[model samples]
Target: MSEREDFVRRFGGVFEHSPWVAERAFDRAASVGLTAGNVHSALCNAFRAASPAERRAVLRAHPDLAGKLALAGKLTAASTVEQASAGLDRLSPEEHQRFTELNAAYMKKFGFPFIIAVKGLTKEDILAAFERRIDNSPEEEFETACAQVEQIARLRLRSMLPGEDNA
Candidate 1:
């Protein structure tokens, strides 16, 4: 089989589990004109090298909302904000209201909604991050966003290939 085909067959499992992740992987591959096989191979190899906690960490680095502020430009900020709010449903109503207030304040201060990869964090943890990061300067926060995006990509690659070495 061609390398591309090999990659697809080996990593197709990832797509089966998370279509959104698969789409992002495919989009990344397409951005570089990589054959499906090569993209699959890279993704599989990356996934294979990551530990479970590392994978969760990667997911946690993504912004809860997308769109105007998403590094990938695939999700809108409003949608991402809604998603974040929904994910916090475990919170008491009062806590939820507090989060909403904090989110608004974060947006006002930073000129962008607070972004966190919300794959694996509890509502409490997410809120903690908001509290901690709300004090960061714009430069610091921008750097954080960039770092989180990279982490998310790495995790996505690792999920696509669970046994391969990335390095």
Candidate 2:
């Protein structure tokens, strides 16, 4: 594959479904030769600099935690693994129902799914955060979602590149 294609193939899903973040970060990655930290910073800078609508698109691109996409086995590969890591994939019926309710409420209030980097968190932790964040103002929720997206991207890059201050 060509270098650009390779770059995108590797890092595109770092930002959920928003490959545009990878597309935008490519120039920087090329310039800096693809260290984990450089690639992570480039991708995050692109995400952070996006217009509100574009950033919201990134947020909207995320699958809801333990929601329909996951139920239907439709989450991206990275998402599947991450959710499993948090035990979200093993939620009981009651837990799933609670996630469903919180997801609906959160979406109704914020116009996007509740997003958190689930790498080192438990289902209870995620549930607690979901409940707590539902009370945030729209602006606060938007910023929080964006930051979570960045964290997710950072973790994804860390997995791919390893051994850098991608944190």
Candidate 3:
């Protein structure tokens, strides 16, 4: 594959289903050098410069946290690992039910899945965030969700290209 094509293939899904972000970032990467931190900043710059509608689509592309897709084994491999890292994959039935309810309420309120980078957080931490964020105004929630999406992408990029210098 060509270098751009290979770059896209490696990083395309960094922002959930949004490959365009990676494609755009590759253009910036050509000039900036493709170190992990530069690639991350390039990717995030593309994401932030996108129209609000595009950003919202990226947010909507995310699966609900510990929701039906996870239960049905349909989350993307990255999502599966990230959620599992936070013990979301091993929730008790009661915990699962609580997550389900919170997921529903958050989506209903915000028009997108409640998103928090779950890497180091426990289920209780996630639930607390969900409960608290569900009360944000639409404008506030949109920005918060977008920021969370960026955080998720950062974590994914860091995992793929690990180094203290990458931070």
Output the number of the TM-score-best candidate: 3
Candidate-wise lDDT, in order: 0.53, 0.91, 0.90
Q: What TM-score would you give candidate 3 relative to the actual structure?
A: 0.96
lDDT of 3 by residue, 1-167 (tens): 99899999999999999999999888888798877788889999999999999999999999998888998999999999999999999999999999989888888888889999998998888988888888899999999999999889888988888783573
Candidate order by decreasing TM-score: 3, 2, 1
- Tens-digit per-residue lDDT, 1-167, candidate 2: 98888898888889988888988989988998788888988999999888999999999999999999999999999999999999999999999999999999999999999999999899999999999999999999999999999998888888888677645
Tell me which of candidates 1 and 3 scores higher on TM-score. 3
Give the poorly placed runs of model 3, Cα more than 4 Å off.
Answer: none
Lowest summed lDDT across 10 adjacent residues in model 3 is found at: 158-167
TM-score of decoy 2: 0.95
**TM-score of every model versus the real structure:** 0.48, 0.95, 0.96
Report RMSD for candidate 1.
10.4
